[model samples]
Target: MVSVVGFLFATQARMPDHLRFAFRILTLVFDAWPYATTGKPFHRLDLPRRIDQVERWKRSRLAFRQGLIAFYRSFVIFGLYSELSKQDADRGMRAKQD
Candidate 1:
């Protein structure tokens, strides 16, 4: 989540102020959405509930909601793979040195 937010901000650095603000507001909404069902913010939810909430968003009928989740999902996956790749590269370098 932190990586996703950082990636978002970094990518949006040159975007118009209004769009940047809208993204920030949307991030808050995403964090708050789980509260309706579990009375807890998204980040504070347990793993199972967090997965459930994301599934709900992915299956939402509203196109905007679907798109929003898709956008975040892409970033999350990218961040995960990026970190993994970085670790792998670091390990390879260490092995070469040894």
Candidate 2:
């Protein structure tokens, strides 16, 4: 999931300006959160920790945070589903080969 998002951002030239802007905002908010005294970015966080933060913010009353969370979440789910489907297809092929 992280790899997909990272790839999209790393290749920002291929993405529309609006989409890039949304991603930047999402990243800013995510990274700016105070995870600990070390002040490391959210991308440095483990998957489970990041998920916990997203779940917490999703339930918050702040509309901006919720919107960002929703946008971020859509990409995550898409990446997860896409990867899962590909893995399933690969598994099926391997099974057929046996």
Candidate 3:
């Protein structure tokens, strides 16, 4: 998640201030919304609960809500694959060194 955020902000550095501000607000709402039902922040939730929350957002009736999750999901998936490939390259380099 941290990596995703880092990648998002780093890649979005040139985005308009208003759009970036909106993204930050939406992120806070995403993390804070779960607190109403679970009495815990989104980050503090267990894996199952976290998945459930994301699923809820993905299935939300609001178009913006659904879009928010979609945006986040894309970054997350991309970040995961990128990290995996990086690790693979590092491992291959180490193997060659040995």
Candidate 4:
């Protein structure tokens, strides 16, 4: 399902360095807690509860990988866009000078 994939994606870099998640703190929360609430004590989650955690771990990992790929690709695209803009501005400046 979509959520499963999403969960795996989130788990990828949910730990150290926090690759590129929604937010730093959000990723930190994921890293700090990869399990579910057991409805018991504040910090109590049964072993089975960890199943969701495992799925999330997998989700995060996949998402992180995809994010890295997307990020690198975007840099290329953005770089091209930036270069074009810069060239356009330079052209205008040159025109004014002429």
Candidate 5:
């Protein structure tokens, strides 16, 4: 969320008010997609935890944390992209063997 906000703030000074508002709305939709399902407002909801709540709750704190980590992991230097590049290189090398 901070990253998205930082991006918005960095561009705000030069961007017109209307465009900035649109940018803000778009960024919010990306960030809120996971929690905004089931047609409910999730920001104020208290999530449940434990076995009984697994299938019944909106989202537990653990899931929120994990999802956030996964989101950042995709773009981090040594995360998804790096791993994907390594896999691609290995596959190319193996293909040469045949």
Candidate 6:
């Protein structure tokens, strides 16, 4: 999750000015959502704190909150699996060299 944020920033250098500005604003909202509900700054708290909140939010009757949880979960899960795939590929290549 943190790596995704960093990768976005590193690529931002090549993005258009307007897109970069929009990305910054979107990042602020994503990072601030937890603090808005939980009162703890995102950097100071463990991610499980936010994960628990999102799990509760997923059970909410409101459509928007549930949708948000679904969307966020998809993104996080995809990133995690992608990282795992990369790690497996690297391990395979290293084994071939030995």
Candidate 5 residue lDDT tens string, 1-98: 23444543554545788866765664454445446454433343356422222332224455544443343333343444556787899999999998
lDDT of each: 0.81, 0.73, 0.85, 0.52, 0.49, 0.67
> Clashing pairs in model 6?
none
Cα displacement (angstroms), candidate 1, residue 42, comes to: 1.7
lDDT of 1 by residue, 1-98 (tens): 34756876576675689867877787789899988878999999999988887898889998766877887788778877888888899999999999
Ranking by TM-score: 3, 1, 2, 6, 4, 5
Which lDDT tens digits does candidate 6 get at residues 1-98? Answer: 34754654455666788866765665555557778677866555688886776676789897756765675566666666778888899999999998
RMSD of each: 3.0, 3.8, 2.8, 15.1, 12.0, 4.9
- Runs of candidate 1 exceeding 4 Å displacement: 1-5, 12-18
Query: Quick one: best TM-score, which candidate?
Result: 3
What does the lDDT read for residue 8 in candidate 5?
Answer: 35
Q: Order the candidates by lDDT, highest first — what do you get?
A: 3, 1, 2, 6, 4, 5
Question: TM-scores, in order shown?
Answer: 0.74, 0.64, 0.77, 0.34, 0.28, 0.58
Q: List the candidate 5 regions with Cα displacement exceeding 4 Å.
A: 1-8, 36-98
Deviation from native of the Cα of residue 1 in model 6, angstroms:
14
The whole-model C-alpha lDDT of candidate 6 against the native structure comes to: 0.67
lDDT of 3 by residue, 1-98 (tens): 34766887675675688877887788899999989888999999999999999999999999878988988788778987898888899999999999
Best by lDDT: 3
Q: What lDDT is reached at residue 18 by model 6?
A: 86
Better of 1 and 4 by TM-score: 1
Off by over 4 Å in 4: 1-16, 20-65
Model 2 segments more than 4 A misplaced = 1-3, 6-16, 35-40, 44-52
By summed lDDT, the worst window of 10 consecutive residues in model 4 runs over: 34-43
If both were scored by lDDT, which would come out higher, candidate 1 or candidate 4? 1
